[model samples]
Target: MNFALGRYFPADFPLHRLDPRAKLLGSLLIMVGVLGARDLPALGLLALGLVATAALGRLPLSLVLGGLRPFFWLFLLTFLLNAYFTPGSPGPLGTSLEGTSQGAVLTTRLALMVLTASLLTLTTSPIDLTDGIERLLKPLRKVKVPAHEVAMMMVIALRFLPLLAEEAERIKKAQMARGVDFEGGILKRLKNMVPILVPLFMSAFRKADLLSLAMEARCYRGGEGRTSFSELRFGLGDGLALATSGLLALVGTIW
Candidate 1:
């Protein structure tokens, strides 16, 4: 019910005031750093950086880590696969020592990656994010890339995440009220999900259809000659943020 991912949290802070382009680029840099991390120390540094960024944004710890809730299964699966299958010496409970270490490292990297991305969306508004992405891709226009359209599609997908989550939750409750048992063995649980999935897909298509109609009614056209109310300007803060992120990325790569 409390969807935090992709939903902007309004606040007056340094992170909130940062230009969207800066945030996007900075987040990407941090993600690169996360990928480059090969040891516990490197991962610790990345984790500290994320905590600091969250602090700068004045975001709640709960909100910052809340993004991981949805990816719990992913993290678990990644760890399990690595721990059970990777070649290494014996470890606790039949897991290899090397495999366990590898699993922990990989899981940490993934968590950091998710946190970085979530923080970007948490701090930046959807509109600003769209503009930022479009502008970043603007140079691709020379190569005939539909920059604006691509940006719009990405943002629209993010916006729909919470809507779909809420819709699924509502459908689940409704089905439960009608005597649908969602608890049982794996097969039974999966079978019970049929009712939920069918209606969810139907609702999604219906919403998409309605959206298309609304756009047509508004005389919607591509971003050929559109102008924005607020122009994006790179200022001192943006430069500082980019420089710091660049430094972090370099350290991650070379260290």
Candidate 2:
């Protein structure tokens, strides 16, 4: 139940001290680079850059691998489906060789994308991320867009992702204690999940209600005149991170 989905892990590393704005923009660029990569060599370079970034951030390897555990089935499914269905020369086991290659590339691309995003969240706090999003979207406010509200919604959704996973685990345990068999066919598993899903939804709603009440009690309002306690400033580390991300993107494009 030690899921790290979009959860912040604090460390005094350079990445942790970087301005959220820099990380947000830099991460976006790196993600775009990952998605735009069309060759294995470029993808390999991108993967290397990601690993180096994680090392630079002082993030634990266990945390990175554990965060990816939830997506193992997804990775497998993506590769399987593409390998079996894509148009290519037939290979061993009645699979297309080219299709399998493409599938492997795609799966790697997806894993790199997820890892990059997870790193962003692991280094940046939820509050800083929220503020960064709000500031980034401020220009849209002139068009009557609720930038602050949107950022708040995004942050809340991210903050709850891991909590929801933990809650689902707890519910599963409770159901198992009551003799609910989660094994067997897909349909049987689906049936077993009903009890867990219902209560998890209810719990989420209850938490949302309490949160609303807490906000009301504190007289909380939108970010119209809100001031931040820690001002985000672009520093040397922030510049380096952005430069590195941009360099990766450039190399990915040309390589």
Candidate 3:
């Protein structure tokens, strides 16, 4: 199933092996900075960072664009809404003296955030990200946030999304064979999706229950006293990445 959301960088670049904590922190900082960015230059730099990271991971443009496919319509909607309704205070926000500057800010922020986050996922493995998350939520352990459990769940979900999507696709195909008209008008298509969605939901619930039982059977209690086999250690490269990200974020915020 293509839905697996595979941890699939080319595995040749130095970035691929860098500490996941570095990647996660960098991504968060970049996202915050990009979302807060109002200036075009800052956004451009953020875009460049995203592109550079993608390149560092040796990811193909096609792969990146494919991820962007689901957002094409979203982008169109954002642009139209911004261009149409935004107050033309700072000289018409649309193409020419049309939309509000606020709308433009929102649209640009959304785009930059999307680009940055996509790059993060592209470069970092799901497992590494989960581990990073558990580490990050260490503070929450004091408050009983079940951070490790949440991280495990997310890792599992990411691992399975593609598989489920594939399963949905297969179900759709089988229904189509049975004269189910799923490829019709939008409303019709959505309703037809029920056949796929119901079973998917059931499967997910069952999987969750089974996973919990299995973990309990294995004597897995919370993260308490849990030692990881793959102990994460931040190295010089991680420091460098974090420093670079911090500098960029500070610049964006200050500017």
Q: lDDT (0-100) at residue 218 of candidate 1?
A: 88
What would the TM-scores of all predictions be? 0.94, 0.95, 0.79
Candidates in descending TM-score order: 2, 1, 3
lDDT, residue 236, model 2: 87
Report how far residue 50 has shifted in candidate 2, in Å.
Answer: 1.6
Clashing pairs in 3: 3-162, 4-162, 86-100, 92-97, 92-98, 93-98, 93-99, 94-99
Q: For model 2, give the RMSD to the true fold.
A: 1.4
- Candidate 1 regions exceeding 4 Å error are none
On lDDT, the candidate that comes out on top is 1
lDDT digits (tens) for residues 1-255 of candidate 2: 656668899888877888898999999989888888888899999989988888988888898768888888899999999899998899978789988999998998889888888888899999999989998999999999999999999988988888888899999998889999999997898888899999999999998999999988988898777889888788887888899899898888678
lDDT of 3: 0.73
How many clashes in candidate 2?
A: 0
Evaluate model 3: give its TM-score. Answer: 0.79
Tens-digit lDDT track of model 1 for 81-121: 99999998999999999999999999999999888888888
